[model samples]
Structures are given as C-alpha cells and as structure tokens.
Target: MSTAEPQSAFKVKGQGTIYLVGLGHASTHWVHAMMIFLFPYIKQDFSLTYTEVGFLSMIMHISALACNVGSGPLVDMSGRRIIFLMLSLIGTGAALFLFGIAQSFLFICLLVSMVGAANNLWHAPGIAFLSETFPKNRGYVLAVHATGANLGDAASPFVAGFLLLILTWQETSMAMSIPVFVALSIITFSLLPREKNPHASSNSKGMNLRDYGSGLANILRTPAIRNLTLVIAVRGMAQVGVVLFVPLYLVDVMMFSPEGQGTTMMLMQVGGMVASMIAGTMSDRVGRRPVVFAGVTATTVVIVAITFISNDLLFIAGVSVLGFVLFAVRPVMQGWMMDLTPRELGGSATSVMFGVQALFGASVPILGGIVADTWGLIEVFYMLAAFMLIANVLMFTLRGEDAEARA
Candidate 1:
C-alpha cells in the first residue's frame, strides 16, 4: 500500500500538475501579450505620443516590481500557491475587461498598473511549485512551462488581429477576458492538487520573519546569485526594448497592417517555442553557461543584422531568429538560479529574480520611447544590442559548474 501510494503521487506530479500549471501560465500570458497587441490601437485612438504609450509599460513593470517583492514572502509564509495563482488569472481578466471600457488616459494607466501587479502573482508561486515538483529535471520542466508562455505569446497577437478585424479593440478585450475567467480558472481549481495542510509543508515550518530576512540577505550576497540576477535584468532590458518598440516599428515604419504585424510576432514566438525545448534539454546535459553564452551571442548578432534589413520577409525572418535565441535562454537562467539557491527558499529566490528583472526592466520602455522620439524606431534595436552585449559580459564573469554538478 505504501509503495502504491508513492507511485501514484509521482505519476500525477509528473504529468497532471505540470499540465495544469502550464495552462494557467499560458492564460496569464494571454492577458499580457494581448495588451501589447493593443498598443498600436491605443496610440492611435488616444493620439498618444511614443513616450505616453511607453509609460503604460513602465507603470506595469513598476507595479510588478512591488508585487514581486511581497509575493515571495506571501508564498513562503502562507503556502497557498493555488490561491495566488487563481488571483493572478482573475485579476488580470478583470483588469482587461475594465480596460476595454476605460475612457481616460489616467484610467488606462490605472488598469495597466493593476495588470502589472496582478500578473506577477503567478510567477513566484508557480516557479516555486514547479521547481520543487520536478527537482531532477528543473531545466526541462521549466522549459515546458515556458513553452506554454510561448504559445500564449504566439497566439494572442494573431487572435487579437483577427478579432480586431471584426470587433473594436474594446469589444475584443472584453471577449478575450471571457475564457480566462471562465475556462482557465476552472481548470486551475479542478486539477491542481489542494494543499491539505499548509502548516505541515516543509517550506513553512520554522520559517519566521527574521529568518526569511536573513536568509534572503545571505542569498543575495552570494556572488553567483548576484551575477545571475544582474545578467537576467540586463538581458531583460533588451527583451523589453524589443517587445515594446517592435510592434510600433511594424505599424509605423514598415507600414504593416494589423494582420501582418500579428503574423510577424507569431513567427517570432513559434521560434521561441521550438528553441525553448531544445535549449532547456541541452542545458541539462551540457551546462547552463554554454547555453546562455550561445543564445545571447546569437541574439546580439541577429538584432544587429535586423537593423540593416529592409525587405519585409527578411525582416520577419530575422525577428524569428532573434526570438529563437533570446527566449531559449530564459528557462536555463531560471534553472541556474534554482540550482544556486536552496530548495526551501524557492519562492523568495524566484521573487528576487523577477523583482530585479522588473526593477531594471521598467526603465527600458520609457528609455526606448525617448530614443525613438529623438532618433527613430530602428535605433532602439541598436540599444538592445548594447544591452545584450553587457548581459553576455556579465554571464561570462560568473564562475560555476554545470547545474547537475551543483545539484
């Protein structure tokens, strides 16, 4: 009986929980990517400048940074992962629905701030759950989790484009919120295993306020953790710059229609979906540093080359290649951080990782907006390339063994 019970739990842990979490992850990203898809419409409908549109993202990230800091302690202290996860979906859906009806720029800023703060509720708990469940295959499992995000990222733009053809952006947003609140929330509650005893969980026992503070401080003080966190933040700047400006470039400079922009963005995310699987599995075998080095190096080269390309098809292909290498490294970075920190501190570590990411990443959109207003949209890619180079240098300075050795 004992043997059977362990085996049954293992099976569900291996298959069922991961699927539920991945689906929830996808749904969370659907809200995020959809907002990005609406940028062109928002800019036009409101007669907003580049700086104004960028402020929306800046507000989002700043709110996210604040939530991320608090979420870690909440996850660790409460041991209520599902509650946090559910709130993430519900909050995002509600915000998007309200945003669709919002009439003023100030109201829009408030909605995006809500989106940013709510959206981060998913990551700290989600990452801690997955990392704990799939300890042996951290890289591969996190990659699978990331692939769900790629799906949401890939499909939202295309779906948003199609809906925009038929419905107003307002109507489309209201419609998009339906599945998240109705379907994804149901799945999350139905399939994810309940925490029978939060007090009994290993993560919470004997963990007090002073201990969490001292532990978090110790974790942050480590050279490897600090270096990895900086690398993520710097690389995030490149990513934020690209995601914020690329759609605008597609609309304004390239003169692409909504459908064309969607297709290009879809292709980029599809490449990420494929490369995520490959990079995550490879990092498990070869090591995280090599994968990080190769991926960032390729990302820099592609972003630089993209500036010179004028042909529409070639430009799309270049962006696709950029997505392949750029996102492929993300799961590896997560796995590397998990390897460096203790298992019990997973939530705090994930929070610290994302907090710094949000902190540094918040600056990119506004900075890119200034650069675009001053020079041109294309110049933003040059700035992204510089950020990527700095990320590569930071990654190189870190001294570590392969994740397997550390584990």
Candidate 2:
C-alpha cells in the first residue's frame, strides 16, 4: 500500500528507509564494539581464558550463518521487511537484556547466540530496501548506511568503557539495550514507505525450501557475484580478526588499559566514518575497484604497521588508518554487488554473499584465538594482513559493469 509513496515527492522520500535501516546497521556494529568493553569484565566474572571469550563469538557467528542465509530470500520474497526489521530489534534487545542478568558462561553464550541471530537478519533486508528506494545512488546511500555503522562502532566502546567506571558490566549492558527502544519507536511510528521485495510477485502461495535453495543457487551462478562473495568473505574474516584482537594486543602487548584501548577503537571508527563517505562518492566517480584498491592496499599497510608499533600516538594513528580503509571498502563492495544483481534478486544476492562473509568472519576469532593462545595477540595481525591482500586481489575480478556504474 505504501509502495506508491516512493515517487510522491514526499519530503522524507526514502530518507525514512535510510535513517531507520541505517540505525540497524549501526546497531549491528554497536553490539560488537560493546563486547570489547565487556570482554575484560566477562573474563573476570567467569574466569574465562581468552580462548573461552573467543568461543562466545564463535558460537554466535555459527548461529548467525544460518539466519543470514535465510534472511535474504525472505527479504527478497516478502512484503514485510519492516516487520522483519522490527522483529530483529526486538529479539536482539531481548537477548541483550538477558545478557545483563546472565550468571553462567553457558547462559551468556546462549544470549549472544540469540543476539547474533537477530543481528544477521536485518542487513540484507535493510540493504535490499535501500537499493530499491535509491536505485541511482546506491553507492552513496549504502555508504551513508555504512557511516551509521561507523558512528555506532565508534561510540559503543567509549560509552561502554566510561559506563564500566560507574557501573557493573551487567548494568552497562542494560544501558546498551536502551537504543533498541529508540529504534523500535522509530520503526513503529515512522511512516516508512513500504518497499517492494525486489523479487517482485510470485504465483506461489508460500515459499518452499526448494525455492530458497534454488533462488540462492541461481544468484551465485554469476561469476562476478561468486568472485565478489569470495572477496567479501576474506575481507570480513580479516576485519573480524582485527577488531576481535586489537583490544587484546593493546592491553596485553602494549600494556594499555581498557579505557586507553577504547580511545584507540573510537579513533579508528571516526576515521572509518570519513573514509566510508569518501569511498562511496569516489566509487561513483572513478570505479568500485579503484576505490577498493585504494582502501584495501592502504588498510593492509596500516594493519602490518600496527604489528610492530609500540609508541602510543603512532599506534593510535595506525589504528585510525586501518579503520578508514577497512570501513571504506564495505560500501563500494556492496554497491558493486548491487550493480551486478538483478533488482528482483537483490536481497537474495546480498544475503548469500554476506552469509558466506559471516561464515568466514565468524571463524576468524576461533583461528585467531588459537594463534593468540599459542603465540601472541600481535601474531594475529599477520594472518589478517594476508587475508586482506587476498581479498584485494579478488576485487580486480569484479564485473566491468560495476566499475562503469557511476551516478
């Protein structure tokens, strides 16, 4: 019914989608960043080794992998993405509330799993909606969405760390769930123009499992998307590795406290915010691969530099640069995928690619945990750099059409 609103010259136009969906993007990163602040507290509370803490994410991501794959086709097929988005918020928020009261290691793990499941459901649908609403400027729009994620990532650790000084980790988690209420209010009250599932109308009364599988298979048959999936997977894996262990490296290797580490994390995300905007615009001008090359190559250099740096100022600068290039690459990659996918299959493509990414990204912590357990936290960077370079190389193989698509 509200689908007709997209062309009515309404003042809000598609911004409703951007703002609400972007908030979800920010929320996704917010959970990860908040966990960094909680890590020390959780470790202390549960007597967890670093490996045990790493396993929390491992379990969460594994659960997310299933949800991510399913969310895409549903978004592609359903007329109720907003409903799905609202549900994602409710479920994740409820899980966070549970996290606040969690007493045992298993209970915390269970809550994180629920949180992960909810988190994975929003992205494909949200991005698919944005792509349909703002077809011409997807690179810029998704970049704006990525910036929301950047701001959230930047804010969460600093806020959580500051809160930890005044409150227990449980209390800080309770506080963290507050944004869910704000987001839910917006989604519930805002007049978001209902976005059509890009897949258009189907004759079937309901989606069968065969439909989901075949739809997903059809999307992946394209070479560009297949290559893109591989690139994003490695990039995602590298990013998770970096974010998961950077705090550990700062605290264990550089002897920085949680507060100091939070500062570094904030700086990195601030830099990412700037880079995401620029890279999205740059992709619309020069091409996705050029932007990809610029961001990833620089990111690789900064990541490797962080390995040896001991100076506080210099290390923070490196972290900042790493964040910039890493976050900048996301929108370009996402926009590139949009360029390659048919409008109808957009949601499915996004989900399948990101699902693979979630798979690889989720696994990084376990592997990095093993490496850190055996060697040192700093050693994790070596693997991260390698994964990033591999991802960078694959970006060269993206569809020429993606490079040509500019506003």
Candidate 3:
C-alpha cells in the first residue's frame, strides 16, 4: 500500500514481537532440522528402501499441505497468531518425543504427519504477523525471522549428531524435544500478555463464504501470484528433495561420520544465515525480483557443481555456497507475494503460497528417490538443478516488482 512511500517514512513497530517471533521460528525449524540426522538412523533401523524414505517425506508434505490450506483463514479470522504459534511448538515437540517411542513404521508415519501439519501451522501466523507489523520492511524483517531458522537449522544437525554419538537415534530425538517444550514455552507465554489478545475476534465478520471465495479467486487470478507460486513450488521441491536425501547421501555414499555430517549441514546453514540477512535487506531496497532472480540463478549453478564434486572438503564447500544462493530467495519470495496481495488477506495469501509449495513439493522426495534408486544419490542433485533451471525460467514470466507493487 505504501510502495511509493520513502523507506524512512514508517518507523518499525512491534520490535520485541519481531525477535520473539524469530526465536519461535528458530525452535520450529530446530525441530524439523533434527529429523535430517534421525533419517539415516531411521532408514537403517527399518531397513527401508529409498522409496519408503521418500514416501515418509511425501506424508510430511501432504499433511502440511492440508494444514496450510486452513490455517490462513483461521489466523485471519481468529486473530490469534500467538496461540497458533504456541500450539505449533507444542505439537512438534510432542511428535518428536513420540517419534522416539514409535514402535512401528505406521506409527512413525503418523508421527511424521503430525510433525508436518504442526510445523507448517507456524508459517501462516508468523509471516502474517511480521508482514502486518512491518509492512514496509517486510523483506528485511522476514529475513531476520529467517535468520532464526538458519540458526536452528545450523545448530540442530550438529546437536542431533553429537547426541547420536552418545545416545541412540531414539534417545537423541527424545532429548531434543525437551528444549522445544522448555525454551519456546517461555517466549510464547511471555507474548500472551502483549499480543493484541483478540480472543477469537473475527476480522472478516461480515464477509460470507461467497465473498471469501471471490476474494481468493481474484488473488489467484493475478498472473504474478500464480507464477510466483509455481516458481516457489519448484524451489520447495528442490529444497525438500535435497533435505530428504542429502543426509542419506552423506551417510551412504560419502561415508561421512555423524559429526562430519552435522558440521557440514551446519556450514550450509551458516551460509544461509549470512545470505538471508544480506539478500533480505537488499531486496527491501532493490525490489524482490532482482534478489530472487540472482539467488535462484546462482543456486542452479551451485547445485550443478555439487553433482560433480566428490572430494569431501570441496563438496562441503559447494553445499555452503548452495545454501547461500538457495536459501536467500525464500524470504524474498514471501515478501514479494505479500507485496502483491491485499494486506488483510496476508494469512490466506501465505497459505496459498506455502500450500502450493507443499502440494508440488510433496512429490519431490519420492521422485528424487526413484532417480536415486535408478542412477545414484549424486544424480538427485542433477534433478534438483534442473528444477531450479525451470524455476528460473518461470521467474521471467512474472511481472516486474514495480508492477507488482502497483497491483
């Protein structure tokens, strides 16, 4: 709404809210990233095939997709962003704890489904909250939020891996779940006092179902939203695919020790942390498309280079570069989508964005599994590179950011 306004015109509000939300975001990601370390062990314990592992990933995405579709409206109408965030933290921790005690593959799948749904529930409220709090600095603020994720992602694998050295995979998962319950509890409960405390007030009280449908249709019809969603879906597919398989690749082909694997994963997140800050701030001033285009392009190149790399040190370095390029664009994509949609519909818009990502990304792991099964783990990186290239082409079909702002 204030696209033409000067950058200095609006002073940022909810400064504490931003950091608190960021901390909450970190805990959510830490819960998710810890699974990467667990996957190798899960695979070994179950004697699962690659396809089965991929199927587990698919379950996670599908569950997330289902939750994402509904969460937006719930957050928008209920005006209980912090409540949903707290619920998400609790659900993820419960799932992780129960996962450690899981006795059967079916039970594990069920727990994974719970994790997927609960993890995604955080995004609608989290993104909508920050976007509303700092509309002008959406890109920068969201990037700072993303930096929390980078820290969590960076820390979890190493922690999980280190724990794995002393404890069983089951024990590591159970142990890690405790902190999520503890640390995030303090942050979320502290916010309860300061939150708008809407107590389930409906923002769209007068809008009927038909009105909501029309609003959604209009939003979807925008070529920019559709194109960005598709590009993001592809990127999500690559990201989820890589996350699902990379640990297995490190374990199976590279023969990396648990600590070595953890450290490498940590490096990738460190690169991502740096990039999210720079790219997020840069996108705020320069517009979203340039930052997204450059990052996605570089990501494609880095992913391609990763496939050819066999040397341990070189491959680890390449992964860090991949993280810098690949992760930088995520918040930019969210900011760009926010710029295009109505502010009131921010929750629904975030759902649409993330839901589409989950829908398409749901297939990535299974597909990547087939590719890995047919060729090798290294070949999955090739698949990811191709997906990025397709996304880059999709980027060009989008209207320029200035046009998006005007819309």
Candidate 4:
C-alpha cells in the first residue's frame, strides 16, 4: 500500500483541474441566479402572486431533493466523475435553451425543475472528486469550488440586468445559454484527466439496491453527520425564506427596478464569494465549529437587523454581512464531513448531508410564500430570523474535536 500524507496537508497534481472543477461549480449557480433575476419578468408576464412566484423555485427544489439523494451514490457507482460533471454542464445549457422557448407556465416550471436537478447533483461527485484530488488542501480547495458558485451567484444579477436593458427576457435567457456551450466545448476538448476513485467500495461491475441502501444507512447512522445535516436543514429554511421573498419585497414594497434587485443580490453574493474562500482556509487552522458557530451567530444577528432595518443602504449592508457569514458555513461543513467519512463512502456521505439540505431548502420557499401571502412580505424576514437563530442553537451540538479533525 502507498503511504498517503496526513489529512492536514495536500499533495495534489493538476492544479488546473481544481480550477476547472471550480468553474463547473460556478456554472450551476450562474444559471440559478439568472433564473432568480428573471423572477420579476416572469411575475409580470404571468400576473402571478407571491405564492405562484415561490412555486417556481419550489418545483425546482422538489426535483433537486430527489436527484440529490440518488445522484451521489450513482456517481460513486459510475466511477466517472468527469462524465457526470460534463452532463451537468450540458444539462444547464439545455435547461436555459428550453426556458428561452417555453410559453406556458407549466413548461417553465418543468425546465426550472430540470435545471435544479442538474445543478444539485453536481455537488456530491464534485466534492468527492476534489477531496480525493487535493486531500491536503481540502478546505481551501472545496472553498474554491464553492466560491465558484458564489461568483456565479454574484455575477448573474449584474449580467442579467445589463442584458435585460437591451434584449427581451427570453432572448437574454437564450444568450446566457451560450456560456454553457462554450464551457462544454472547452471541457470536451481540454486535457483534464479523470482520477481513479481509491475509496470506491463496490466492485466496478455494478451496484444493487441492497448495496445502495446499506451505504446510505451507514452514513445516516453517524451522529455528527445526522446533527450537521439537521443544522443545514434549519439554515436552508432561513436561506430560502430570504432568497424567495427579497425580490418580491424589492418589487412590490420598495419599488426598486429590476436593476436594483439585481444589485442587492449582487452585494450579498459578492460578500459570500470572498468570505467563503477565506473562511474555508481559516477552518483548516482554527476548526469548523468556531467558523460555523461564529458564522451562524453573525448571520442570526444580521437577519435580526434586516428584520428591523428598512433603509435601503442598511439593508444592503445587512445582506452583505449575512452573505459573508451564511456562505462560510457550507464549505466548512462539507470539509468536516469529508474529514470524518471514509474515502470509499464519501459519495453517500456528501449525498446524505446535501439531500437533507435539499429536502428542507425546497420546502421553505413554498412555506414562506404562504406566509408572505397571509401576513405580508416583511413577516417572512421575521420567520427567516427565527429559523437562523434555531440553526445557530443546533450548530452548538457539533463537537469540539470533530471541528478540528483533518480529512
């Protein structure tokens, strides 16, 4: 057997591979943000209520929930990390292209659901790939990959807004699909080599339902995994609450133009993009518990502030702070999970955590929509704050030692 280095250090080759994976990660959320920016246009065109608007994201989440659970193990089963990634990239383009042509509400929802599924399924394999590729730099490298999503998130609003000024929303959607085609071309022709999965437990032949169930059951049995999974579930509730309603508030209550809403989203995501990378590196040195606890605590405080503050500037500041803190928790948690799970089961492990997140993340928008329809949009922020506070309390359940464990 080969002598592998300690968990705290990385010995990765093909540095560009990390960047490429990061780019792949970025593409998922870039499409997501583009969809978000289209919300106003959709609402106006369809004469939709807040509930209907929330339903759009809700359907996507539902599809994502199912796919996230199965896709992780499938990636492990296939043993073709790069292949799954390419498919995800291609799916992104197809979804956007479909959206560009779709006329009815039903078809729009269907396309969104497809995009959501494709977007989410990437995380499991991508996380596993990076963990194997850069074992030593796990925190920073995962953060880089996650940072790509945030960059996509941050950039899309600005790009969409700029494009909206000149083109129809459908035209803009079609144009955005162009990047995926370009990215796919590069990935297809590029000399990116696929790394072997050293931790694959099943033989290369095939996996049965029993084997898949056993792997899943094994991951769910871990105390830390169960706890962290629940923590994210609660946090995701608050996150979806914020994301699903903020645009409505901007359009209906604040009377901000589409550009203003995009700018607000841009501020929050930009904060997240920069902070996530830094937080991941910091977690490697200080520990995941401190980073997550500190982040959730700050996020809770900011949510509370956003709840009360009505001024646009103050709210933007709050969004920026919330972005920085909330975004940091995701990658750090992934790194911690990687540290504890055996390499062979990393796929199932990541899936378990991500699937829990998707289950809750998908529901919140619809639930929050009901709240917005009943109480008002402002009330949703209060609920968002409450969920974040509860998540912070849940985070304390994570152990001191687990936080410091290296992969």
- On the 0 to 100 scale, the lDDT of residue 259 in model 4 is 74
- Taking the tens digit of each residue's C-alpha lDDT, what string does model 2 give over 1-407? 01121221223355655766788778766775776657666877788777887888788778788898788777766544677777777887788767788888888888878877887787877777777667666777888889988988899888877787788889889899888767777776662334333223322223466775676677678776788789888888988887778877776678776678778899999999999988886776566777887788888888888888878889999899889888999988898888777666677777787788889877787888888889878788999999988977887777466434433
Arranged by lDDT, best first: 3, 1, 4, 2
Task: Locate the minimum summed-lDDT window of 10 residues in model 4.
Answer: 197-206
Q: State the C-alpha lDDT per candidate.
A: 0.83, 0.76, 0.84, 0.79
Task: State the TM-score for model 1.
Answer: 0.94
Better of 1 and 2 by lDDT: 1
Instruction: Tell me the lDDT of model 4 at 43.
Output: 89
Give the C-alpha lDDT of model 1.
0.83
Can you list the residue pairs that collide in candidate 3?
Answer: none
Which residue pairs in candidate 2 collide?
198-344
The residue-by-residue lDDT of candidate 4 on 68-149, one tens digit each, is 8788888766655677778888888889877889899999999989888888878877888788656666788888888998
Residue ranges of candidate 1 with Cα displaced over 4 Å: 1-13, 197-206, 402-405
Cα lDDT tens digits for candidate 3, 1-407: 46454243135555666778888888888988887667888899999888888999899999999999999878776666777889989998899898788889999899889989998999998888778667778887889889888988999998887888899888888999987898567876777664654323224232456666777788989987888889999988888877788889999999999999999898999999999989887888878888999999999999888888889999999889988888999888888888888766778899999999999999988998898888888889888988999998988888664445721
